[model samples]
Target: MTTVLYFGLFAMSFDFISGYTGYLSFGHAAFYGTGAYTVILVANGLVPLFPTSTPFMISLLVGGVFAVVLAVVIGLVSFRLSGVYFAMITLGFAQVLYIFVRGWDYVAANPRDGPSVGGTHPAGFEIGIPGVDQLNLAIGVLAGEEATVLGHTLGSTAVSYYMVGLVALGCYFAMQRILHSPFGRVMLAIRENEERAVAIGYNTYLYKLGAFAISGFFGAIAGGLFAGFRRSATPESSFYFLTTGDALLASIIGGFGTLAGPLYGHLFDETVREFLSKSGQGGGLLPYLRAGLGDQALATPIFGDMTLGVLIDTLLNGHASLYVGIVFVLFVLYVPDGLLGTVRTRVGGTLADAARDRFRDDHSTPERTEGDDE
Candidate 1:
């Protein structure tokens, strides 16, 4: 779930620009990597002038600023083109960064493996109000704080979950607010028809650039949060093009153009992955089947030396990607608008509006008398 929160935020940031502007940022992971590396580097005191004592919140903000700058640099050139060309260019930039980071010794002793939080910073990253010890709460699986309230004790993992959730929720609302603004409407306009938007005297390029920068800022924050919680960042995990691909997959599964849809989509993805995990981390199918079925049934051969358990293990134990891919294809073919988008369409507006209308109809319905039927 913590993975869903931070990665969901990254997906939402991707949707903010790609879904709204119809310009896919195939290399959006560049900003994500930058933010992750920045947080880890700052914590290790390798970043110039920024000491290891720098507050976690400050490091996140600094990373966000860095992402914004990187976005501007990338967008300046990429936005000059449109469609697949733009995507390829952005992807090229990200790939270049990935390779550089993979080989850059300045980043770590073994840059290929990336960096981890060392002796310079041993505590969990704080996530509340900066400079206020009481207001702040540390977040990490093992390094977080634990508290008891009303005889119920919250463990470190639970504390990290709530803190990370709070930040992700805040970022979601901020993006939602932006989506409802005039600037966001312009973004929609550009997506609908760039030529028409240009004809209307709007500098579509600048709007796209601004949107890209904003998205990058949020994307970086998400990366920083991820690094904060894990206490590590890696090139393959953070800078790889597949990182952006994951966000793209979430946006498509959740609902492109619907700001909050990607979170649900990513949650679904994670749920499926965990369920089919080889190690059965979270009560996966393999463990359940093994526990439920006896050894006799499992050992019974259905084919040439392939028993029931062996078949299940071979086909389903760690093949979540196959199932997820099938689901994605079904969604594209039958539910093109995605889960939330289809619901919104059926409701004729947002979920809140639908609920309000239902309430009004229920209250305004005329009362029936005994003779009314006659």
Candidate 2:
């Protein structure tokens, strides 16, 4: 769960720029992987060179900073392009990174033994059992002989659930604020019509670069967590361009401009994966689903590629992405607003009705009631 939450943070950050700003960056996985590797590099030899005894908190912060810096570098290079060119360019960069990682025999062959990443933590800092300092706070404290004061330390699942939930919440609110800001207004203008926005004294380049940089920056943070979670940094495992596609799925499947929508999409996809994996198709949802019933009779059809066949039979059971993509296509074609958007529309209608009570006077009430009845 902690792991999922970390990925969610990166996804939310990606959501802010791509989901809200309308740039479909397909290279975010590079940032995510870079961030994870950065954490490993720092936590190991790098920390000792600069400072003494770098703790987990420091590791997390530095990982984020490093990813952001890398994002800036990537943004400056790629945001100048647009449309398919932009997507392709970002992909090219990610591929370049992937190739480098794959070819670097030392990094490639490494066993990925690094500092472990995450675990449990309390929500909001309320010094449980007053007078307890940092030391006593280790493993939480006792409130007059009861360990329940600060609440039980969350399990891995609970921790991840809460962590991801908070980050998602923060991302939603923060993006909402940004969308309502003057800069966000410029983003809207650019999205509506970039040429027109540029003509109206808005520097589209700067706006685009800013959005791209921030989006990549957050994605990198997610990548860093990915490496950290596994305590390994294999070239193939550390970063992959396909991962960015995952983020893109979240953005497109959910309405592009709405904050909560992409998150809903991402959550749905991840949750589905989790469900499928847990079911019996040899550890993958698709394969498990494709398999027959009665006592685990699953079929994993395949093409000629042996590696893919093996991996598919093992991890995917079949083409998980294909199945998921089909679902997305169907959703986009028919239910365009996505899972959350659908819910929001329903909720919006309910809330709108709830808002009418205060506006209704005796005369208006009768008409409103009639309208409601009708």
lDDT winner: 1
lDDT of 2 by residue, 1-374 (tens): 44445565666666677655566777777777776666555545444453423443344456666666766777787877778787788788888887776665443324354322322223211112334333222211121112223857544334334533454465456656777899888888887788888887988888877776666655655555455445555555556776767766776666566665666667777765665553543355554445534222333334554443354457654345566777888887988876656665766743345457535643373436556766
TM-score of each: 0.93, 0.69
Q: What is the lDDT of candidate 2?
A: 0.58
How well is each residue in 1-374 modelled by candidate 1, as lDDT tens digits? 88899999999999999999999999999999988889989998888989888899999999999999999999999999999999999999999999888878888845454543333354459899878888778887667788676999988888888888999999899988888899999999999999999998999989999999999999999999888888878888899999999998898889998888889889988998888888778899888888899899899999898999898888886688999999989988998887788899999989989999999998996889999999
Which whole-number lDDT from 0 to 100 does residue 237 have in model 2? 57
Model 1 segments more than 4 A misplaced = 109-123, 364-374
All models: lDDT? 0.89, 0.58
Off by over 4 Å in 2: 1-4, 47-52, 104-153, 163-168, 278-322, 345-374
Per-candidate total of colliding backbone pairs: 0, 10
Residue-pair clashes, model 2: 10
